[model samples]
Target chain A: MFWMTWRQHRLTLASLAVVFLGLAGGYLLSGAAMRGSLSLEAVQKCFVGTPLTCPEWAGVISTDRNLRQTLLPVLPALVGVFLGAPLVSRELEQRTFRYAWTQAITPRHWLTSKVLLLGSAVTLLGAVFAAVYRWWFTPATTGAVTLYDWFDVFDQGVLSFPSACLFAFALGVLAGTLTRRVVLGMGSALVGFLAVFLPLAIWVRPNYLPTLRVDADSYYSQSGGWATDFVYLDRDGNEFGMWEALSRAGVTSTTSFGSEQEELLARAGFREMVDYHPGDRFWVFQLIEAGIFVALAAGCVALTFWLVRRRSV
Target chain B: MTETAIAATRLGKRYGQKWALRDCTLRVPAGRVVGLVGPNGAGKSTLMNLLVGLDRPTTGELDLLGERVGPNRALDRVAYIDQEHTLYRNFRVHEVLKAGRLLNPRWHEQDAVDRLHELNIPLTSKVGRLSGGQRAQVAVAAALARRPDLLILDEPVASLDPVARRDLMATLMAAKADRDCTIVLSSHVVSELERLCDHLVVLDHGEVRLAGDIDDLLDGHRLLTGPAATADRAPVGTCRVVHQERAGDQVSLLVRGAPPAADPAWHARRVNLEELVMHYLASAADTTGGGKHPAVLG
Candidate 1:
């Protein structure tokens, strides 16, 4: 049964290997080059963000590591659509499952072995790529503070990315089993992954640990605002945004909260309040998110397994 | 194990609200070639699926090779090749045989290789590139390699050309001569099963219309020719008229059971497999008020 799985999926596996090697090699070269460029003053200046003072740093950063950040999701999506969706649906759509499921190996054993081999491959590669990403990102901040936002760190982190790969692959299998058509299965996997992923990242990840509130002198500094979002707190410790403060000071949009609003904010003793899941909580969030994703992955796989056994034509 | 290769009692399979095959009670003694002959949508495939355990029965019990159908019970004992003879289109021919060797605990690898070699099928040829005949042969080779006690094939040559059909049948015959396995295959073409099967099953409207050893079924049916005016007047002698057709001044009546006591008024002879199947199918359609076109045998 394992031999049959290998024979059937060797082509998809080889292509994925080529893509994985290309991405890994490309990231390694770019990350190493960036590490060497840290000696340059301009490179150091743009490390925080798009510093207007250094056009060369902006050019390099934008053209370089920014792509790697966005490319993280692509790997998992490929695993889901190309690998997982076709695993069952192709067999069914092509009418080959009629030949396969009738062999000496039952459908249950056939699926179990295939998932074991392919799922292990997905998880191992996902882990390796994630570790490479963490290595690539570490030098940008020099271990002092985060240069990107919490979401960026959370996305390219070591633990959660691997679990996300498993989740996508498993969801793909579930979609393929339910849909029983290749293109439809691939589409469902993509849509399902996004449906679960966006909400989890946007609404759920930050709340894994309660936010730590801190008062910062500057509202737009790399530490207080870039890494975390901040709102204004009045003398009464009431949180407020620019709209409330501007309206209270009678500053219209035409004034753009010019010096008049600033004066009023100062008089009211309004300070920038930063609510953040601190850097120390990064791993804790990773652990929690990883657990949720793995559980979801298991759920998808369990459902797929049950459907394979129960479903018939 | 029981000598009965397949014993299905009231076996039925339904899709949605309609039954594809229903109330089918079939029994085949071991070691004989069984032909499941039917027209399109006659539930031949459905019955084969139940026998091979590819489908769950909607209504009854099936015991194959003396074991109940399930994930663990009959998988290794039965080998089935479906209508299209589906294989991994991307894999080379040798890889498919290798998969067979690896998947089945009882596989005979050399036999598959030798079978392919005799058919002059190249081991390195990709399955997608092979001819339909070659694909069917390769599928048969793989199925035979498993050394199954019972082999079930559904519409094995429904799409093959005449030459390919003859060639695949030859391969299947050779395999039968080489093994002690019981083979049950379905085909809509009556001629296809006439030369290959000793036991016959006729399925129409999702029901078994006629089933038994071919010789026994033939002995039970009689074809009578007489004047059109005398078709109803002739002594049928405990025989039931199955179908009647008139050509000009003469009438041909297909009867089941004993002939008209060898009357001189009519000529009586045994029915062939094709005529027997067509008569039963035509009579079934007649009973159902044109449920199926009787010309389906064409």
Candidate 2:
């Protein structure tokens, strides 16, 4: 049954090959670009900034690392949506599920075998992609990768992506079974996939980890409306007070608060607290999300089986 | 004990407010090719689906090969070919046969391959590339290769050309000759049914209008034509009148039973299987007033 399912998805396997080649080529070119810009002197210069003096935001040009890190977290999701859409939809669209289901096997058996076989393949591809990305970026981040990245790259590739694909596939199967039209199945799968995904991406992730920030000076200024002078203290215990003298003294700067009247005090010593670091914790989170997605996929699969077995066609 | 190939007790099915099949009690022993015949939407496919456990029945019980319908065991012994082409178009014919082998515990790869070769179907040719008739043949090959205990087909030849349909039917007949499998096939092509079937079941408006051995059903039934007076005064014997039409004093009546001894007034002739089936179906359709309601005939 597994081999039969593999044969059934031969096109998908070919698609996966295309995906792998594309990812690999893109990674190689991007790595070459990053390496071209990275000299030993450049690395030293990046770390040789004036300490605890002023906001260093000016020097932080959005580098390839930054872009890759930001984009990498969401790449698997798009892949998930794309790869998952055709898992069941195309078969149903072509009226082939009826053939597979009526074999000397129950609907559950048929579905289970396909899910296991295809899900494993998707997961392996995802893990390999994630591993490759990790190898390329490990020199810089050095294991600081977050659960978000792992889930986005590895866990989702194997677990969540496959689950989503299964969900979409089952949805397509149900639509096809009921409507007996492949177009309806494809359309419903797209609509349903987005309906489940967009909301979770926009509304859910932020709430999952609540962050509380306290701007002490802003609170002080609000409570006691004083036109205070900027105070600057060096790491060597040298101190300067008042606005013009503070400017000469360095170590602190005032930036405009949006397009507002009041100037906001920006401190240089402390960077914003990052809630979750990239690494083991991220993997844990990925496992949890994967578990949830797998559960949902399993539910959809069960419903699909019930629908197929009980359905008239 | 080895169970009957298929058994149903008051098995029924409903699609929302509409009932597709009701009070369908059938027991088909192994090793016989039974033909199910009906017009469009006459519940023939519905009955086949129920027997093969493709669709669950709304009421009563169904058992296939001793296992309850809907379980894996029942499905393992049963193979079904629906009215539509079921083979994946993207896969070559060989892949479809390989799928059958993987799916069925009692698969016969050699037989399937040989049959495909004999039918002139290229193993490497994808189903999508084949003509409609060729695709239908591939579906038949896949289903038959499984070597199942019970094979249920719903309009398997609906899309096939005459030659392909004849070849498929002959292949199925040969398989039956070689095995102890029970076959229940449904088709609107009554002539083919007449050629292939030993037993017959006729369905109309989701009910069993008539079901029995073809020979027995035909022997007991006769079409009688004569004057109204002669027909009315004729000995009834073991016959029951089913349909009647009158042209002035001349009347024609369709009855089910043997001829009366030494009867001279009435002209009694045995009906051909196709004509007999058409008569039952026409009467059934009329009884339900254009097939809106269900009607059962014994």
RMSD (Cα, Å) for all candidates, in order, is 3.5, 8.4
Return the number of clashes found in candidate 2: 8
What lDDT, from 0 to 1, does candidate 2 have? 0.63
Cand. 2: chain B TM-score: 0.90
lDDT of 2 by residue, B1-298 (tens): 2547777899899889999998988876766678898888888877886776566788989877787775454376677888876777777887777777777787888887898898799999988899877787788777777777888888878878888788778888888888778888998878888778888888878888788888888887888877675666656676788766565776666788775774576677888888787778878767777743232222
- TM-score computed on alpha carbons, candidate 1: 0.90
Those runs of model 2 whose alpha carbons end farther than 4 Å from true positions after fitting are: A32-82, A134-194, A216-295, B1-3, B229-233, B291-298
Question: Chain B TM-score of all predictions, in order?
Answer: 0.93, 0.90
Candidate 1 off by > 4 Å: A33-46, A49-60, A142-151, A217-229, A235-238, A254-263, A269-271, B72-74, B226-234, B244-252, B291-298
**How does chain A of every candidate compare to the true chain A by TM-score?**
0.86, 0.58
Interface RMSD of each: 1.7, 2.3
Span of 10 residues, lowest total lDDT, candidate 2 chain B: B289-298
Error of 2 at B261 (Å): 3.5
Candidate 1 lDDT over A208-304, as tens digits, reads 8777676654333545222345677877777788678656645556546566766777776777677776555777778998999899989988898
